[model samples]
Target chain A: MRETLRYVASRLATTFLIVLGAMILLFALSALVPGDPATALLGPAATPEYVQRFIQEMGLDQPWYRRLFSFMGNVFVGNLGTDVLSGQPVTRIIANVLPYTFILTFSSIGLAVAFGVPLGCYAATHRGSLLDHLLAFVSVAFIAIPSFVIAIFLLLIFAIWLDWLPVMGAGEAGNWFDQAQRLILPTIALSVGWIGFIARLVRSSMLETMGENFIRLSRAYGLSNRLITYKYALKNACIPTLAVLGMGVGRLLGGAVLVEIVFSRPGLGRLMFDAISTRNFPVLQGTVLVVVLIFVLTNLLVDLSYAAIDPRIRRQGSR
Target chain B: MNPDLPMITIRNLKLDARTEHGPAHILRGIDLEFGRGRIVGVVGESGSGKSTLVSCLLRLLPSNIERLEGEILFDGIDLLKLSPSDMNDWRGRKIAMVFQDPMTALNPLFTINTHLRDVLKRRFPQISAREARERSLAMLTKVGISDASVRLDAYPHQLSGGMRQRIVIAMALLVEPDLLLADEPTTALDATVEAQIVDLFDQLRQDFSGSIVFISHHLGLVAELCDDLCVMYGGTIVETGPVAEVLARPRHPYTRALLDCEIEDDHGGRLATIPGEVPSATWAMDACIFASRCAHVADICRRGPTVLETVAIGHKAACKRSREVLP
Candidate 1:
């Protein structure tokens, strides 16, 4: 128990450092944006006097370190400052956009795990069979194509050609079915890479675990094939897959940006893209912070889940 | 003695294992029988097909491997003819196995109780979880695990190597199998622990009516413990008899060579060893498989396959000149 607590505490510290590092990188990158910050925010219609007044009012007149410090402080207090372009609080804009991205990321991962694990199990059990070869080919194909290309192809086939699903938006505001229908294409595009990678991972790991002594013992005891495969082999196989999934979260978030842009979904990806073009520094920084935070937290959850999945790990942790 | 009434009989069992290269001859028409409540020791060096023989008995060979011919008669049922599902029912329940490496034999993820419960549940599906737990506790205690109740919740990694082997033995015996195939169960254990485990096996034999086929390379253990002994060389039994008789007067050159290899603590002499690699089963052998290493090799011994023939009362040796071969 103490070991688990210590592990959690250390992980939480690592998470903090990662998020801080990400914020510093985001701030440095934003500062390197070409053109005067005040001019970019105020636009061509603003005179010199108006630009200076806007710069002073928005704390752009302060030193870079001071601005960074205050931005960090504001972030801790849940106040992400205002978007200079629309004069809206960055937090409000993020709050409005997060649900869409959340739905996309979670659903994509859900689909990935749902399909990847079974496909991997099937491929492993049916090694050298026709079905195994087919799954291997399909996984390779999915992995070979980039997410954006998959998104475009899915849009082309399902939306443009068949008119089966919407090409843009997060569907009607209150209608769950409409939202689910709209999410289908983007979700597939986002999840395809994970499915391929995870399936391959699970297949190799399952094969390795099946060769383990415990598996042989289980077979010797005449355990049912289903019990042996799912209970014994799959559990050992899932450890590596879980670790991959944990690391995959950050990649998934990055992948979500392209998927969201392609689908024209009103999510953080779309919001950040607009913020980048408009030089809305606060919105860009805040969106990046949220992504970083999610990535770190997901990793921590993965580490904790390891203890739950394998009691040996739990015992080690307690020790 | 009613020699016709054997608990298990293996007749003309031939296994042709499909290797990456092609089919390799594994077992060359093996015939063995064990009486009820007997401890039979199958002793052989590596690559002699001792493990393969037991795997065939359990029908646990990999899919690629094919059994060319065999009749494994147990309680009037042919194990070779049973469907995979029926075989599953027989495994663990009727015929259990204890493996070599105690460290890796039990699943690391599962607790002792869970491992026991899984085996118990298979046999007694209608038993409640609490009753299963009770049985598991009782079995753990029976296997000589102290603090049995607490040990039930412990993972395999939490226990010492000897403890883990005990747990594995307990699990295999939990269902009270009619036949136990222990494939070098003490090979991975230290000498002290090996002695302890062997003692436990001896004790368990008295309480359980099941027969045990103890496969090992250790001649001392086999000679000390086994009632019946089969000495294998290159996938065929070179000698078989009552353990005491075989240990006293081995009739095959290979068996004599093996017995000579076991050094006594008091003997301050150079250790004996048979020279020559075990012939690959993939290669066609028209003569004695051990002819290359045999000091007694003669022209006829190298010209044709030798068959097991009675050289004494209830003792057999598979050598053409068994009468000439001396211990």
Candidate 2:
């Protein structure tokens, strides 16, 4: 328990460093986007006096270091600055957008795990049979197709042709069915590849684990293949899956940007994309920082999960 | 002894395994039998097709390696003809197999208890989870594992090599199998542990009344542990006899060479040895398989199919010149 606390403490420190680094990078990158935010906000024809006054009022008159310091200060105090256009705090915009992305990410992951694990088990157990080959082929096909291509294909079939679901929406319809319908295409598009990726990973790992002494030992005890697959192979099979899934999380988020665009959902991806074109410095920078924070936290979660799943990890961590 | 009663019969067990070239002769015309409760040892150097022979018995050979024509009868049931689902049932219940490398055999992610319970659950459908747990603990105890109940929660990585082997032994003995097929079970273990395991197997057989087909490259272990012994070469048995007789007076030239290579504890004035590498089964051979290595080369050996004859009671050797080869 004490070891867990200490590990968490060290991770917290690392997370703090990550937050700082993310903020700095976002600030620099946002500043270097080629066009000035002030210019974009003013738009083409403005008198010198009005431009200078607008710039000063917006705190563009301040030194780079000074602006950065205040930005960092506001961030530390849990106050990300407001969006210049909406007159809404960056935190509020993010809080509203985040849930859409979060739900999609979580739902897609749930789908992948539910489908991938059993398929993996089946393929590994069958190995060289027709079922194994067919499953492998399907998984490979899903993984090979681009996510947008999948999104468009799913959109074409599920939305355009069938008319079973909406093509695009920001969950604006308020009805749960409408919101869920909007999610289906994007979620499946994002998740289909992950299903393949995770299943392939789980299968190979399961194959390896199945060869392991304990598995053989289990069989020698007259254990049924099903019990051994679930209780032995599945648990042993999780480490590689966890690794692939942890890496997949970032891809899922990045993939969501394109999916969110096609579906027109208001997510951090869409928010940041709009912010980029408008040169809305605060929103763009805030989104980048949150993404980094999410990434670092995800990594920490991976570590914690690793410890939870394997006793060898807990023992190593404590030592 | 009924002398004629072969408890487990293997008739014309011909296995032609696939290779890069194509079907390699794995087992050719193997007709052997094991008496009830007898310890049969299969000894050969690496690549002698000893491992392949046991794997065939279990139907555990890798998918590509096909058993062409064979009948493996365990009591009255034709094992080779059983379905995969039925094979799973037969395995560990009727015929249990233990392998080399205790490290690789047990699944790493699970606790010993989970592994034990899972196996028991398969064989005993009516066994309650609690009963499985109880049975697992009892089995562990039978294998001489102390604090059996406490050890269940422990993972494979947590246990010593000796302990792991014991656990595997405990697992194999759970249903009290009619036959136990152990393939190089102690080869990966340290010498001391190997001795302990061999001794444990002896004790286990006494209690369990299960016959064992022990396969290994270590002829010493086989000589010490087995009652009946077979020496395989080029995917076929070159010689077989009562262990003491075979060790004392080998008939097949291949067997002689194998025994000749045994490391002596004290070199008299010179170390004794043999000169040859085991020939690959994939390489087509039209002569006596041991002709390439045998010191006594004859023109008759170059002819196909080295025939086996009962040179002595309960002793057989597959060689054209078996009469001259033996002392």
DockQ of each: 0.71, 0.58
Best by DockQ: 1
For A1-319, candidate 1 gives per-residue lDDT tens digits of 6766776676678888988888788778878978887887778999999988888898888899998998788888999888877789889998998888888888888999999999899889889889788878988998898899999999999999999887698898999999999999998998888898888999999999998988888887777789989998998999999999888876666456777878888887777788788777788888878878888899889988887778766556544
Query: Model 1 chain A: which ten-residue window has the lowest total lDDT?
Result: A310-319
Q: What is candidate 2's lDDT per residue for A238-269, written digit by digit as tens?
A: 88898777777765664578888887787878
Error of 2 at B242 (Å): 2.1
DockQ versus reference, model 2: 0.58
Clashes of each: 0, 11
* TM-score of each model, paired residue for residue: 0.93, 0.89
Native contacts recovered by model 2: 0.71
Q: How close is candidate 2 to the true structure, as a TM-score?
A: 0.89
Worst 10-residue lDDT window for candidate 2 chain A reads A213-222
Give the C-alpha miss distance for residue A185 in model 2, angstroms. Answer: 3.2
Which model scores highest in TM-score? 1
